[model samples]
Target: MRQGLGTQLRHLIDLLDGAVSAAYEEAGIDYRPRYTPVMRALEGGEPRTVSQIAEAAGITQPAATQTVTLMMKQGLLEASPGVRDARQKIVRLSAQGEALLPQLRLCWQATRAAADSLDRDMPYPLSDALAEAIAALQTQSFGARIRAARATTKSKKETS
Candidate 1:
């Protein structure tokens, strides 16, 4: 039997992230794949609010908040009051996170080369496919597609 699309996508993510996680472990870096986006967002050395981080990282605010909270707990990020908004928390890399830059840069370079090699082996690049898929979903969401299919099914049933 063929695997479902969701299952296959999950398996792909697991395989990719598992290898990435192992790479960090082997390099003696205690970081998670999820943290990379937020780190990238804050790597510019400018403090930004959670909404700004979310926008910069191409992630949802809630996801950014969760990641920022976790990173803060791990001492990789520091949060302070936004300049004009006392309730808004501006986030930036902590000293520890700054210290990891050189190591992470090396790891990122290696990961990029490995990804290039992987793309060369395949007919279609995974990164391109991901971008295309994201674009398609932005055009017509999965829920919309499912609802259209459901309507067609109902029409077929009514015709019968």
Candidate 2:
């Protein structure tokens, strides 16, 4: 029997994750798949709040917060009080984090090259297709439920 589309996609994701993780390890960098999206989101000119980072990263606020905390401790990020809202904090990458950006890019490039080499004869469109699929899935009911659950968990953690 043929495997389901979701199963194939999941397998692909797993393979990609492993390749990326191995690349990061080989490059002597701590691998955090979750942090890459958040860092990429913050690559824009503006500094972002934890909530904004979470939204951009497609992760729950609590997860973002925890990741931010870890990055901060690692000197990869710095948090400053917001100008208009004293209670709010804005997060940005520190010098160390900025320095690591190129390494991250290299790791991605290596992973992409590996994927491309898997089927050299065929034109590989998986990256673009996967990105589009993710964007579409983000607007679906399952995505909404996942995000809501993450948010709820974050809120509960904060309250406790």
Candidate 3:
């Protein structure tokens, strides 16, 4: 039977998550799935507030707060009072977290190498295409549309 597009997309996400988790495990790092997306967003070298990280990670503010708290407790992140907003806390990777970047990169490289080994013919091109797809999906319009659609569907279901 042919899978629906949603099912295929979900499966692809599951595969990627599993691969990434395994890579992190092999590298002897504790992989917090919820925090990975936020950390990835911080790769641009900018310190972000909890709300900003929540938006980037597609999670709720409370979820982001909890995740940040956990990471801070684990020495993976440092939080300080925001310069502009006294009520908000700015978060950034701690020295220990920064020190782990090289190891994280190595894990990512191993994961990429494994993926490339699976498809020897056009690995680089396939990787490039995936990167392009991710970049395209990162647009604000794409995310806003997705959120709106979900909200509409939920409201309709509730009324029914």
Candidates, ranked, TM-score: 1, 2, 3
lDDT of 1 at 68: 96
Give the C-alpha lDDT of model 3: 0.80
Candidate 1 lDDT over residue span 102-156, tens digit each? 8998988898998999989999998899899989999999999999999999999
TM-score of 1: 0.96
Better of 1 and 3 by TM-score: 1
lDDT of 2 by residue, 54-144 (tens): 9998888899999999888888888899999989989998888888888888877776687677656457666666678877876686668
**Better model by lDDT: candidate 2 vs candidate 3:** 2
Model 2 gets an lDDT of: 0.82
Residue ranges of candidate 3 with Cα displaced over 4 Å:
43-45, 51-70, 114-160
After superposition, candidate 2 runs with Cα above 4 Å error:
1-13, 115-125, 128-139, 143-160
Clashing pairs in 1: none
TM for every model, in the order presented, reads 0.96, 0.65, 0.60
